[model samples]
Target: MIVHLIDGTYEIFRQYYAPRPGHLDGDGREIGATRGVVQSVFTMLQDGATHLGVATDHVIESFRNNLWPTYKSSAGMDPLLLGQFGWLEDALRALGVAVWPMVDVEADDGLASAAAVAAADPRVEQVVICTPDKDLGQCVGGKVVQLDRRQDKLIDVDGVIEKFGVPAGSIPDWLALVGDTADGFPGLPGFGAKTAATLLARYGHLEDIPADAADWDVTVRGAAKLAATLVAQRENADLFKVIATVRTDAEVGTVDDWHWSGPTAAFPAWCERFGWPRLAQDAAALAAARS
Candidate 1:
């Protein structure tokens, strides 16, 4: 009844940098991150997750790059980690997990889209978006929630307000004002988290804020300077807001398609190739038990 959507891109990056032993295939290609992701997915399956889907960036550069020239790209990324992106997708598919290998759009878009679709399904009890990414917070509400597996935290609608000091709907506006360095957009000057949150808590959005600082009801420090910056960079802030917004139109297919049916026959061979022969047996045993 619960649908779990994973951020495969984040998992790969997390595992690659994690303090664990490195792994290489017979050809000496790095696959430590791929192996780690497979193990992580298996843990989720073993822990009673039935409906699952993973979203990965098939190409790191998405449409956001075209929107903002400085948006996040694959440049300077560790080749070892980058090389495993495709391999991770293949491994997950071989393990019988639904994989969304995003191309022009980023992985976050796929998660947002899938979360939206799953949340709309009447049969779904809850939709858990498994990522700590702030952008995903916009999708939090009703039956949908964000789960940070690493932090062991669940962020619901109220949790979004508690953490950001603004409601879930105001996340893009907040990010636009405060800036998101990860997404390669600098917001208006003199706007930090507290200032943005405080202002947004009252106005609810960018356009609604009064142009004059004197008209503002909030008590943020440097109100005049902040108001001046907002006036000067209002256009830029709107553009950044567009960049911060996650696209929910990705082709994630139906929620029924996301059910975990167990590993495929190719999974065993794929595991051996990755130098983890025991993973094949473990996966098969788990599949049989679940079946």
Candidate 2:
């Protein structure tokens, strides 16, 4: 069995910006993103993904905000995008899809936790983390790979090495050094992508990097300034390391909660509510075929 964990926040964002049009129910309600998720998951299941779980931010504020005041906040996000979170969760559940509504933890944390637990189960052949977020790369193990559903690409341990130029184990350390704008953190001032990759490739971690730029050999420009900045912000670096690391210990109730048993008997009702005659037909057909 291959466990598929999804990042619901990222999906909502993607659907919001996608070329798709807004969806209206028979009652003239908006559920476009919810409808998009349904379409995406159907494609995943039809494309050979078996066991699946989708994690969404029940609330955007998490423990990371306590660590850094400047961390990404859901505050000021577009209202339309924010409005879809609940509708999406409800729609997913109404369709019998497994949903993790994250609160103090996060969507990524749920994916990490599920991946860790599922990977440990000997019956499971592999665990697939489905998201393009770089933070989740830290959880990639030999049996676990990251699959970008949008791009139709699968990245293994070697792909992590190829793109990040560092092993999966060192991704958090590399991210801490390079910082991530998407996560709302600034990395060291002088460090660029190449320089960080080169040093991390050699040293494997931030602490292992030499204190003296004079001893460097990777030939990154302004190595002295980079070295000084790292040394000066050592505490900040460690904090960033903690922030960059995804917690694989979220208290998800159980894997049975995530089994992909297909859509519910209410599929037709849900489709009628959403005004998706085509999806209603597809669900009925898929359910009947499975039966």
Candidate 3:
């Protein structure tokens, strides 16, 4: 009854830099990361993960780029690493795992959307969003949680509060004030984590905070300056919040559609083409045993 939503983009990046041998196909395409991800997913299946889905960044640039000129893009990324994204999607699909290749929206949005869909299903016991991205923290609550696979960490609602100093609902507001360098947005001036968390803890949201620091109940150092910065950049703060919020309207399918039936017939050919013939054998053996 538990549903696992993976961040394929993160996985590929992680594996690419990990201590491992490089792999190239007949045409000299780099595929070690892709192979590593396939192995990792198979390991997940072997370890009792049932319902699973993976979301990948089909294109690194999203609508957020149009909104902010400095939003993260794939400009400096290694061509070899970037080249494997589509192959990774194809490999996951061949493994019979549902893949959401996000283009207009990023992989994080797809995970958020899938997590929302899975959490709303009555038959689901839990929804695990498998990523360590701070943006995904907004989706953690109740039956839905975020998992850091690399660290074996599980973050629930309480975990979100413990880590971010605010509740899940306040994450966007918190990010807006504190800024997220990963997403390429500089938060309001004079508002660091402690200041943002403290103010947000008291006021709950950006719009709810009093215009004058003297009216605030909490005492923050440089409160007057922070208040002035917030007041001056109110419009920019709102825009930043919009950028921070993960869109749950992405077209991730329902829970039942995410179930892992087994690998497709194309899997063996894909493995051979990718120069991992052992993967073909392993996948077939696993599928046979499971069947």
Best candidate according to TM-score: 1
Q: Which stretches of candidate 3 lie over 4 Å from their true place?
A: none
Which stretches in model 1 have alpha-carbon errors above 4 Å? none
lDDT of each: 0.93, 0.83, 0.91
Compared with the true structure, what per-residue lDDT tens digits does model 2 show for residues 65-133? 999888888989988789889988877776667888999988999989888888877878988988988
Query: Could you tell me the C-alpha RMSD of candidate 2 in Å?
Result: 1.8
**Pairs clashing within candidate 2:** none
TM-score list, all predictions: 0.98, 0.94, 0.97
Candidate that would win on lDDT:
1
- Between candidates 1 and 3, the one scoring higher on lDDT is 1
Model 2: residue 163 alpha-carbon error in angstroms: 1.3
Tens-place lDDT digits, model 1, residues 112-170: 99998998899999999999999999999999999999999999999999999999999
Better of 2 and 3 by TM-score: 3
